[model samples]
Target: MTLPPELSPEHWITHVFSAKAARQGGVIRRNLRDIERYVGRSAFEDELKRRGYHAVENAGQLIIFCNQEPIRLIL
Candidate 1:
């Protein structure tokens, strides 16, 4: 996933969960704009929602709070 142009590369991308999987230490990853064009987290979140996933964003990371289990996501 790409990052928002407004946020610099130095920023840290962390997944934020609401009621579920709140203690998974919050998955952290690099927003490598080089690998992919900087797409906003909002856009990704919307896409996930469009596919029937419950998600939200905290800072730069988009966290999909799946009901059954946390999918140790790779960024």
Candidate 2:
């Protein structure tokens, strides 16, 4: 589908798209993120610690303490 020309990444997240192509009734997210922050292949370090997700960065992509093990990864 063609989005508005002015549409941005943040705008896309704010778009309340129906989960027609996904599972169950649907899922909606009150996105509290700024897309610009995650662009350019940046690593997701802080989230790893906050969310308990695994960190598997190849190199210097990320640097954080997960549970206690030093990890590096790009979300």
Candidate 3:
């Protein structure tokens, strides 16, 4: 799934749930511009953790893990 251009960090939680339920592995692309609007990257990451996602960000991309399985995510 592509990240919504204007997604707020709170709304991002929904996407995480959906992706996890779908078991859709492989790159889920996101826009860095969208991410930059988050109040704080650490807070956003904390929220992700609350919803059972583990992510690593690199050069405007994210590698996500759900249930300990890698999900190729780009942000």
Predicted model with the maximum lDDT:
3
Candidate order by decreasing lDDT? 3, 1, 2
Query: Positional deviation of 51 in candidate 1, in angstroms?
Result: 1.5
Q: Look at candidate 1 and give me any clashing residue pairs.
A: none
Question: Candidate 1: lDDT of 71?
Answer: 57
Q: Regarding lDDT, does 1 or 2 come out ahead?
A: 1
User: Runs in model 3 with CA error above 4 Å?
Assistant: 1-7, 20-29, 69-75
**After superposition, candidate 1 runs with Cα above 4 Å error:** 1-43, 67-75
State the displacement of the C-alpha of residue 21, model 3, in Å, after optimal TM-score superposition.
Answer: 7.3
Residue 58 Cα positional deviation in candidate 3, in Å, after optimal superposition: 2.3
What would the TM-score be for candidate 2 when compared with the true structure? Answer: 0.24
| Highest TM-score against the true fold, candidate | 3
Residue pairs in candidate 3 whose N, alpha carbon or C atoms collide under 3 angstroms: 60-75, 61-75
lDDT of model number 3: 0.58
Residue clash pairs of candidate 2 = 57-72, 57-73
Q: What is the C-alpha lDDT profile of model 3 across 1-75, one tens digit per residue?
A: 566557766677566446644365433444454555643566656765775666666678765555555556455
